[model samples]
Target: MELTTLWFLIVGVMLIGYFVLDGFDFGVGMALPFLGKDNTDRRLIINTIGPVWDLNETWLIVAGASLFAAFPEWYATMFSGFYLALLLILVALILRGVSFEYRHQGKGEQWTRWFDQFIVWGSVVPPLLWGVAFANLVQGLPIGLLPNGGWIYEGTLLTLLNPYGLLGGVVMVLVTFTHGLVFISLKTTGDMRERARALATKVGIGAILAGAVFLVWTIVMHLDHELLWLIVTCAAIAALALIGGFVANLAGREGWAFTGNAVGIAFALLTIFSALYPYLMYSTIDPAFSMSIEGAASSQKTLELMTWVAVFTLPLVLAYQAWTYWVFRKRLTRETITAGAH
Candidate 1:
């Protein structure tokens, strides 16, 4: 494959990693009010993801950096166009990370509650905005090229608040919420585990419903694309995976449930990226103004150099993250939390 296409796939892989890993982290955070019945329950829930939430977040950083490096023009157009939305996501992430650290350091219960709220909002905002943002990308943006070859976004933030975009946000929220519940079920024991599993089954239905609409909308929008079949296949698999996850959760199989949801999330993303192939950013302003992958990518030499660096570093990063998860693999319990044995 050409370097430009390779980098596009690499960027897609990094994004899929972010969604698959941090997606559950987002799920766990959003689940706070639902699953956490008491301070002990809350702490147990938090501790389930405490060890690796930040680590999972690293994939976003890598994805962003890779986007900037591999497709500078695409990066520029998206960052500038989605500036306000991205800023909100950034602030939410920072607040969420801070809440994770400072919630325990509070002097009193009220202080901790404040941070807990932050954690919940922080988890909720990013995924919703991310969904809106990506949905807009698939739906096409009002972007146009300038005389100087610069790109300009002709729409405002409010323009992204359309029905389709909002539905995309809702779908993401439901998917991640269910994903987190499954994670909780996978990583906890006794009543909490069973509660999480039950909740996941309930929420997974919403995820399936909303995800079906969003994916169908996406496929319909791209019916003229040469890769329509790829998009359709991915969307079909995503729907099945989500239903399979719901069934697995019902059957008392937390591991398979989590895996199924993860696969669902991954293929949902694959459906989007597959639809978005060739054009990094589609232009609703004018089809001629859309940013193609070749038009937006960095030079061949830069891509080749970055590919070499990734070849050396990517495996090591994967190995270290795997080891970290393995080391913290034991299920958490309220008894353990009460016994101070995190």
Candidate 2:
């Protein structure tokens, strides 16, 4: 494969990793206001994700760094075009992470409650905005070529708030919320698990409707007829997986339910990245201004060197993270959470 194509897949893999890990984290955060009826309940909810939320987030950093190094032009144009939106996502991430750490530093209940609010909003905004951001990026941006061999983004924040962008935001937020509910059902036991399962059933239905709309819209707009069947196949699997997840939750098969939900989430992301193949960013203003893998890539030497570095280090990183999850694999209980709370 060409180095440019290789880096595109690598970057795509990293992004998928981020979504799989942080996707559940976002779900858990969005659930706080719903499942956490009391302080102990909230504590239980938080504890489910508390051990590894930060670690899950590192995938996003890795993905961003990879994008910056391998495809600077794509990064440059995307970041500049989505400046305000990206800033908001950054702020939300900080608040969400901080809430996990500082909400228990001998602070009062009120302080914790306030921080919980922050956590919820923090979780809420990013998925929504990310949906919007990615939608706008894929729907195409007002990017243009300069006189010199450079690119410039000529759109404002308002440009990204178009209907399709906003719909993308809503779809992601709902999807993550349901994904978290499934996770909660799996990792928690007793009343909290039951509540999570119940809520997930309801949320799952809405998620299916919203997700179906977005999935169909994506296929209709971006995919070519030759490859249409392939994307449609992925979308079908996603729909089935989501339905299975909700059904499994209702049947008290929590692990199976979580797996189904996770599979759906993965396929959903795959559909998007696959639709974006060849082109990193398509310029709405002019197709000639579109950025593709070959156009945006760094020097061949840079890619070759990075490939060697990745060959040595990436496996170790994945192994260590997998080990971390294995160590923390046991389910959380209301008793455990209450004990920690006291």
Candidate 3:
């Protein structure tokens, strides 16, 4: 209800949008070798996402910008502390974007092959690192206060490579990979659809397993949290949605499968955000050093101004993006790809 809380929720919404949308984009990129049997097949796979991948990515940009504007301290601490990891994510994204554009323009199969590899790796590194980063946030970071009233992150990159963080990364990779496969099932036809659905059913099991572990760990960590009920509820929904997705995929119901995965991913993130509600970043060193939402928020005037701007702009952006997806709603087929229809 307050401006600070409203902005926090807005930022969360933007991030959830990114992960749900671009999450599948990453999965599709990673599924390249498995689903793409030939150049044409690969093209079909790529074309399935080509129209909207860039658009999906804009959600991340909006999320980042909102963080910087609405909660500068949180953004500053996170960006500075996670500099190396964020840099890697940035490079990977750039490489993936470049590969999407240049893969077709290259002179030979070798050139395109290299870019294909880029696409796969590009899709992988960001989500893995993001999962690690968020896990560290939930697990708490070694942060201390400066004499000048600023915050300092005492831990190095290696600190983020701990068991919990690594498991988080793996879970993200598995879930997103499953999400993408389901999208492929939803967006393709004939043999491609069958193969994708079969693969999704298989991968969805791993997603369910890993996601359950991660969610249980998170819930255990937050047993004493004020929002523990919300966390538990969201986690339960996420787990069920994942299982439901697997069953839907097995039953050859692509739309429901995709929707199930999407809901699972969204609620899983909601679980995390709920757990992190009061604090922007928790301090392992001392609770006194932790950054609370109120501590991290921008001035009240700034938040109010931003709220007005969002009220005007957010719906238009949503409408345009929804229209784009609707326009590209038709399934892609081998014939469509061979006939050069994207």
Note the Cα lDDT for every prediction shown. Answer: 0.93, 0.85, 0.93
Provide backbone clash counts, one per model: 0, 0, 0
**Residue lDDT tens for model 1, 305-336:** 99999999999999999999999999988877
Clashes by residue pair, model 3? none
Q: Using Cα atoms with residue i matched to residue i, what is each candidate's TM-score against the true structure?
A: 0.98, 0.95, 0.98
lDDT of 2: 0.85
Candidate 3, residues 86-201, lDDT tens digits: the string is: 99999999999999988888668999899999999999999999999988898999999989777888899999999999999999999999999999989999999999988888
Q: Which stretches of candidate 1 lie over 4 Å from their true place?
A: 338-342
> By TM-score, how accurate is candidate 2?
0.95
Between candidates 1 and 2, the one scoring higher on lDDT is 1
Between candidates 1 and 2, which one is better according to TM-score?
1
Backbone clashes counted, model 2: 0
- State the lDDT at 105 in candidate 1: 80
